[model samples]
Every structure is written in C-alpha cells, then in structure tokens.
Target: MRFAHLRVEGQTTPRLAVVEGESAIFLDEVMRRAPRDLQDLIEQGPEGLARVRSAVGAAEPGTSVGAAEPARGAVDPVASDPAAPGTLPRHPVADLRHSSAVLRPAQVIAIGANYAAHASELKLRSETAMTIFSLWPNSLTAHGATTTWPEDLTTQVDYEAELGVIIGRPARGVHARDALDYVWGYTVVNDITARDIQFSEAQWSRCKSFDGFTPTGPVVVTADEIPDPQELWLTTNLDGSIMQDASTSEMVRSVAEIISLLSRSATIPPGTLISTGSPGGAGYSRKPPVFLRDGSTVTVSIGGIGSLTTHCRVI
Candidate 1:
C-alpha cells in the first residue's frame, strides 16, 4: 500500500495515511493502535503491516472509515459517496498538505556519481569506489514545500532527479541477489544542490544539505508494488521546460548493488533512506547554467512512485 504523512490545513502535526488514488484514509481513523508514522510502521515489521492490512480490509466499504470517521461536516462529499467512482471513506488528497515521505529516517545516505552520464558531465570518476555522502536531516522537507537559500551564498543551485529507497530490515553483508528483499518502499527525491559549494568543498554533504534541500514524497510505494527498480523512469521539469529525462536502466550501480555494497561493512537499519543518485541533465551542465531562482518551481518525477515539486526562493 502507498502511504504519506499528511495534515489538514492549520494543523502542525502530520499523521500517517494510506493513499488510494486521489483520496487519503487516515490510519488512526481505521486502526485503534495505528503506528504513529511511517518509521513506526516500518519498525513494527511484517506483523505490523499485516495488522494494518487486515484492519483496512475488514472495514466495510463506503462506511466513512471503520470507527473514527472524520468530525461532523468535515468529509468531502465527492470522496465519501458510496456510488461515487472510486469512492472510499476518505478525504481528497487535494485537501491535505504533505510532510517528508520518510519522517525520522534513521539516516539519509546519498550515492554520488552513480550514473555514468551524471558522472561524465561533472567530470567525476564512476569506475572507482562509490562516492557516498550523508545528507543532514535538517535538509529533509515535504513535497510542495518552499526551499530557499540566500543569494550571496551561491548562485548555481541545481536540481537532480533521483530514486529513494527505504530499507525494511537490518541489512549487513547481504548479497546482491538478496539485497532487494530488505527494501521497504520507494519514493521520489529531488536532490537539490548548490553547485558552487559542491565543487569548492572537499565534502559534498554541506553544499547539498541546505534547509529544505531534499524534497521527497508525495507518497511511498511499498516494495511489493515495484518488481524492478531499474525499469523506472526519472525526469525533472524546471519552470515549464523538461530538463532531465532518463531511465533507472542508465545507472552505473543498480539499487541492489548499492545496498549490498553499503551493507558489506555496516548494518543498514530499517527506515534508512538511501537516495540512489541522480541522472544527468543537471542545470549546472547546461550551456549556460539554469539555476533555480526566486519564484522558480521545479519538479522531479519517478514512474510508479510520484512527483515531488519544490518552489524555490532566493533571498
């Protein structure tokens, strides 16, 4: 099942909800002891998920959720009607706001130069040891949120479209063949970066970890739904133009390989989010860089997952 952290307007707390097309079923409304967030649900393991599945399945269709229906006059009529096409006892996703897809992830590891084209364009070596970096948790933000940076800091801000993998179980020394079994789900990520800082700093984490730099979600799709991560397509749209269009098939290191390689030395704990590098077509490599500016809107989309959009502002 697909899940997202969403909240109604005027609320500061985000609640985990199961997404069904354009509607969202807040888990607390259906399950008495629902996991508070995606991290909690993932840590609960298979039994936890099974319980959720059973509870959601047991509820009568079109009953406005099992026992914790929305407060009176709060339901959207179009999404609650039993006869309405694809209706459920749910609220329209359009009515809700999003939080980071994987809140409180154990860690956010990023793979760099994992795509041949992206590596070649940046003049970085892809044949050598993997270029891995940690993204600061403060950088994490939700889809549709605004990401701003000071103008004096850097002018070459760019967007990278990438796939995010969330681990389901502890993974250490796992073979490539078995790496995927540990995956919990997938989400879209826009690895926004400040190109100027990236090249000057010896390490990459700081340049890319500006507040709101990593915009993820809309939703996370459980691994069972994605049979092959490499078959997906990733694209980036800046303003109104399509800037990056590529396939996961283009990665120099497949998702399984990256996981296995990382697991060789350290235990990849459950709820860890690994951003599997971005494809080429970065604005920095354009004839004249097309950096994000105040009022610019960028979106990164991964097939089967969802699109994550960020509005940019330069102070």
Candidate 2:
C-alpha cells in the first residue's frame, strides 16, 4: 500500500492517507483508531500493516477506501493519472498539499561516495570505508515545495537524486543477507547541496542540510511491493535537462550492505531515513558546471517510488 501525509489547502496540519489511483482516502475517516502518521503505522509492526491491508481490501467498489492492485511487471506509477471515477468521497490528489514523507523520523543518515561514478566526478574516493553523515531535521521538506538559499551564501547549489530507505524496526548487528527484512518502505530523495560549502568544509552535513535542502516523496511504497531495491533506476531533471541518469546497480555498496554496516556499531532506530547516495552527473561535475538558481524547478525520480519535485528560489 502507498502512504502519504496530505492536507487540503488552507489546513495547517497534514493527515495520514492511503493513496489509490488519482484519489486518496484519509485514514481517520475510514477507521476509528487510525494511525496518526506513517511513523506510527510502522511502529505498530506487521499487525498494523495487516490491519491497513484488510481495511483496503474490505472496502466496496466506488468508495474512496479501496486499494488499486499494481499490475505485474510494471514499475509503480508516481501520481495516479486523472482522478479515478467513483462515487466514494475520493479527493483528487492534485488538490491536496504534501508534507514530508517522514514527518518525524528518529533520525536521518546519509551515505557519501557510495556510487563510484559520482565519487569520481566529484573527485572523492568510494573505495575507502563508507562515508556516513547526519542531516538536520529542518532540512526535510515536502514534494512540490520551494527550497531557497541565499545566493550570497551559495551560488553553486546542486541536486543529487537518491533512494531513501525507512527502517521499520530497531536494527542492531543485522546481517547483510537479512537487512532487507528490516526496511519498511522506500521513497525518492533529492539531496540538495551547496558545492561551495561542501568543498570548503571537512564535514558535509551543514553544506547539504541547509533549510529545505532535502525534498522527499510524493509517497512511500511499502517494502513488500519492491522485491529488490538494487535493480531500480534513478534519474534527475534540472529545469528541462536530464542531468543525472544512472541505476541503483552502479552503487559501490548496495542498500543491504550499508544497513548491515551501520547496524554493527549503533542500533538504527525505527523511523530512521537512510538516503542511499547519488550517482554521477552532479552539476558540479558538468563541463560548464550546472547549478540550481532562482526560479529553478528540479525533479528526482526512482523507478517504483514517485518523482519528487522542488522549486528553487535564491535570495
């Protein structure tokens, strides 16, 4: 099942909802004790997911409370095309505003130099031990939102398309082979960065964690729907140009390995979001060096998870 945090225009608070094709069913309206958010649902474990599945399955046709079965061999489509036709109190997804896919994750961890091509382009080495860093919560923003930074502070703002993995339970000393079982779902992430700060500082978080730097989700696809995370394709479009194009397969370390490695020293708490790094073609690596500027619109997409778009404003 696909889950999202959505709110009608003018509403300050976002409510948890299950998304079907082009429409959404707010959980509070359909169930008495609905999960307050994706974090709550994940914390409830398998039983919570089972309950949600049962509810969606039991709904009658023409109602907003039904689930749309994904077609075999097809990558999940981003937003449902044109609102679905039905009598149910279905609201058009297009009309709703989005909050961050994960509003209250336990923590946010990012991997650097996981993709050899990206490492090479930026003149960093991926052959060394894994590069890990923390992102500030203030950096997290919703899809279709605006991300702005002072041009005087950073004229070289850039975008990195990445796959985000949300941990379902506390993972401590997990084996690489069993790491996939610990994941709750996947979301698309645009790891926006300031090249100037990145190159100048010894550490990375501040350069990449500027307010509204990380834009995640249109929605999060549950783990069961994705059989293998390494096979997915990822791409980035800056304005009208396809600047970053690569596959998860190119990563020097796969998702499972990164999880297992992190779990060895620290317990990866539930609700933690791990951005699995980006591929080559960063604006900094371009011949003329492409960077985000005033009025720029950037979209990052992973095959199964929908595209995450962010409007850029430079002050």
Candidate 3:
C-alpha cells in the first residue's frame, strides 16, 4: 500500500493516510488505534502494517473517524468532507498539502558517487571506497513545496534524482544477501545541491543540506510492492525537459550492498532514509551548465514508486 503524510489545505498539522487511486483515506477515520505517522507505524513493525491493512480493508463508506472531533479545524469526514468522490469520504490528493515522506527518521544517510557515470562527470575519484554522508534534517521538505535559498549562498543549484530506501529494522553486520529484508519502503528523492560549495568544501552535508533542499515523496511504496529495487528506473525533469535518465541497475553497488556495508560499522535504525545516489546527465556536466533559478519546477520519478516535484526560489 502507498502512504503519505498529508493535510487539508487549511490545516496546519499533517495526518497519515493511505493513497488509493486519486483519493486519500485518512487512517484516523477508519481505525481505532491508527499509527500517528509513518515513523510511528514503522516502529510497530510488520504487525502494525498488517493491522492498518485490515482496518482500511474493513472500513465502510461514510463512517465517522475513530478519533474525537478531528483535531480542531481538521477534516470531519462525517460532517464535512469537501471532496468525497465515492460512497466513502475520501479527499482528493490535489486538495491536500504534503509533508516530507519520512519524518523523525533515525538518520538520513546518503551515498555519493555510487554511480560510475555520475562520478566520472563530477571527476570524483572515490570508486575505491564508498562515499557516504549525512543529510541534515532541516533539508527535508515536501513534494509540491517550494525550496528557497539565498542567491549569495548558491548560484549553481543542481538537482540529483535518487531512489530513497527506508530502513525497517535495526540492521548491523548484515550481509548483502539479507540486506533488503530490512527495507520498510521506497520513495523518490530530489537531492538538490549547491555545486559551488560542494566543490570547495571537503564534506557534502552543508552544501546539500540547506533547508528545503531535499524534497521527497508524494508517497512511499511498501517493500512488498517493489520486489527488485535494482530493476527500477529514475529520471529528472527540469521545467519541461528530461535531463537525468538512467536505471538503478547502473549503480556501481546495488541497494542491498549499500545497506550491508553501512550496517557493518553502525546499527542502521528504523526509518533511516538512504538516498542511493543519482545517475549521469547532471546539469553541471552540460556544456552550458543549467541550474535551478527562481520559478523553476523540478520533478524526479522512480518507477514502481512515484514522482516527486519541488518548486524552486532564490532569495
């Protein structure tokens, strides 16, 4: 099942919901003890997801949410569901606001130069050792949200389309053969970067972790739905042009290998999102380098998952 953290247009707090077709079924409405957020549900393990599946399956149309009075100014399906299309009270995804796909994650780790083509274009000579870095939580933003950075801070803002993996359990010393067993789900990630700082600094955290730099999801697809992570396709569309196009198969190391290597030294806790690096065709590699400017819209898509869009702004 696909899941997202969404809010009614006028609401300030986000609510967890299951995405079905074009409508959203708020978990709070159908279940007695709904997991608070994706993180809450992940912590509960397989049983938690099973329970959610059952509740949504058994829910009847037009029934009251299991919660009390819908959190003040929140959608009251029983009383006011503005866009209930079917017999059930469902909200159209277009009318709701989005939050970062992963919230309160244990940590956000990113692999750099994992794709040989990407590494070659950037002149990174680190194929001998894996390049990994942590992304500041402040960078996390939502799909359809606008990311802004000061013009003085970065003039060469480029986009990287990556497949994000969410860890489902505490993984340590895991072998590549069993690494995928720890995945909770998958989501699309736009690893927006300030190329100028990236080349000057020794590390990547600050250059890529500016507030709102990382826009993830529109939704997260569970692991069962995606049988082979390496078989997926990733693409980036800047404005109306397709810029980055490649398959996850092009990675120097697969997702399973990255997880296993990461787990060898540290315990990768539940809800940790690992961005598995981008493919070639980065704007920086072009003859006339392209960069995100004010009023730019970028979308990153991963097959079997979903497309994530982020609007750009420069202050």
TM-score, ranked from best to worst: 1, 3, 2
Residue range 7-50, candidate 3, lDDT tens digits: 87667778888987777778776555677799999999998998
Please list all clashing residue pairs in model 2, or write none if there are none: none
The TM-scores, one per candidate, come to 0.92, 0.92, 0.92
lDDT of 2 by residue, 1-315 (tens): 889998887777888878887887676655556678999998889988776675555444466422322121221121212122342245678888999988899999999988999999999999989999999999999999999999789889999999999999999999999999999999999999999999999999999999999999999899988899999999999899999899999999999999999999999999899999999999999889999999999999899888999999988
At residue 25, candidate 2 shows an lDDT of 69
The list of candidate 2 runs beyond 4 A from truth reads 64-88
**TM-score, predicted candidate 2 vs. hidden true structure:** 0.92
Model 3 alpha-carbon drift over 4 Å, by segment: 59-88
| Cα lDDT, model 1, residue 49 | 87
Candidate 1's displacement at residue 6, Å, is 0.2
Per-residue C-alpha lDDT of model 1 across residues 36-149, encoded as one tens digit per residue: 999999999998888667655543445443333254322322232222233335777888889999899999999999899999989999999999999999999999999999
Candidate 3: deviation at residue 302, Å?
0.8
Clashing pairs in 3: 29-65
Candidate 3: residue 299 lDDT (0-100) = 95
